[model samples]
Target: MKPRLGVPSDLEAVTSAVIRTMPLDPQWDYRFPYRHQYPADHYKFTRMLFEYFLDPSFDDWLVMVAEDSLAPGDSISVVSFGVFDISYVNKRRHGPGYKPQDPVTEVENRGGKTRRDANHKHFNEFWKGQIRAYKKYFAPLGPEQMHLQILGTLPEFQRRGHASSICRWAMDHVLRKSLKDMSVMASPMGYNLYTVLGFERVGTFYIQVPGEDERLVLQAMMYKPKIWETKTTEDGDGACVML
Candidate 1:
């Protein structure tokens, strides 16, 4: 039978599995410092984000798992990503949304206005600035827009089709609802998998290793599926649609 498809109901198990595999998944190790703003024990970081960013928000996020079948202990593969509802937008300078009339956000208060529109105004403006500052390297985004938060597989389980399963599963789920385009910052190991799934390169990002001077490079990949390609198949067979 196919492995289950829900956020891992057990918080600890889910975090443990993902963290234990982090070294083998360097993007996780490299992105960790930036993701939470401070150093965190691998498992603790995964647990905190899973509980806060993913678990309770099932409607907007999907966390899928593949199990051992026999041992069936923790997941062997974990992919956690989400789609922002139409109402949501990205901002570069804003924090989370504030109440419309909060004491802080009155139009008279410029700082409050900036914070209130972080995801929308701040993000749009930020991208514009990035374009101006990095014109030689930056390229424009295409019509579709979606983001891939994370995808990882234990090294022991690599090449068993687990990675492919996770990508196809998540993409199928979004496409069935006719989600806008999807995107991800792909690690070197992940680039091939995304390409196989029809995502194309759009840009790149570089990050310095936490304690080293060397920088690691990542590709920004995006996909805009043909509207008619709304069907999902397991291992490329048996068409089904995921919600």
Candidate 2:
């Protein structure tokens, strides 16, 4: 099978595949954890933000998909990465153009209360704050700050080295230029894959997915360009050079 980078032109198909293959476990006991107790709209608000809006327009973003034309079109595995332009990020943050118009913000501002009811105010506030914190932590990046947002393989495709192939392609295509480092919030099952791919442990935290006990989340791993160097610096120092 061959793999290729997907474009926004494939958004409809990608979105459809995501909805069809995504597990319905409330705790999101899969690759990327998030709440989903209610199938209709647990994360409906933020769905457009990350899966649609952000994924579509981000120039440095990549969606590596494996496919076989003679077979079914379902993506057997995928690795999504984004190299955020820090200048654009800074402008949105510190610059006047920084519009607080993301999905959550809109929901909060329009509904006037997240829970839409007075009794649930406190719970709503707490939950909203938690999600906001996650977004804030994941948002900022220098001009070439790159991150692997999600990587996973279908159970049938495991042990096939498809993930490794995607990672290698990502290193070259997404991190090819001025990107200083690559990072990911690792899933427990993916730790070994990342370690072998040259990522080193960094930190850990607890991620609460609704209906499931809190899981230990690792912010553990960073990929430095120098470590995979096919090129050397003039000064003879080839560490993860700062961007």
Q: Considering every candidate listed, which one attains the maximal TM-score? A: 1
lDDT of 1 at 235: 70
**Decoy 1 TM-score against native:** 0.58
**Poorly placed runs, candidate 2 (over 4 Å):** 19-37, 42-62, 69-143, 208-215, 227-243
lDDT of each: 0.50, 0.50
Q: What lDDT score goes with residue 190 in model 1?
A: 80
Clashes of 2: 2
Clashes of each: 7, 2
Q: Compared with the true structure, what per-residue lDDT tens digits does model 2 show for residues 81-154?
A: 22222233444356655542244354556443433122233334334544444355444543344566556555
Please report how far candidate 2 places residue 158 from its true position, in Å: 3.0
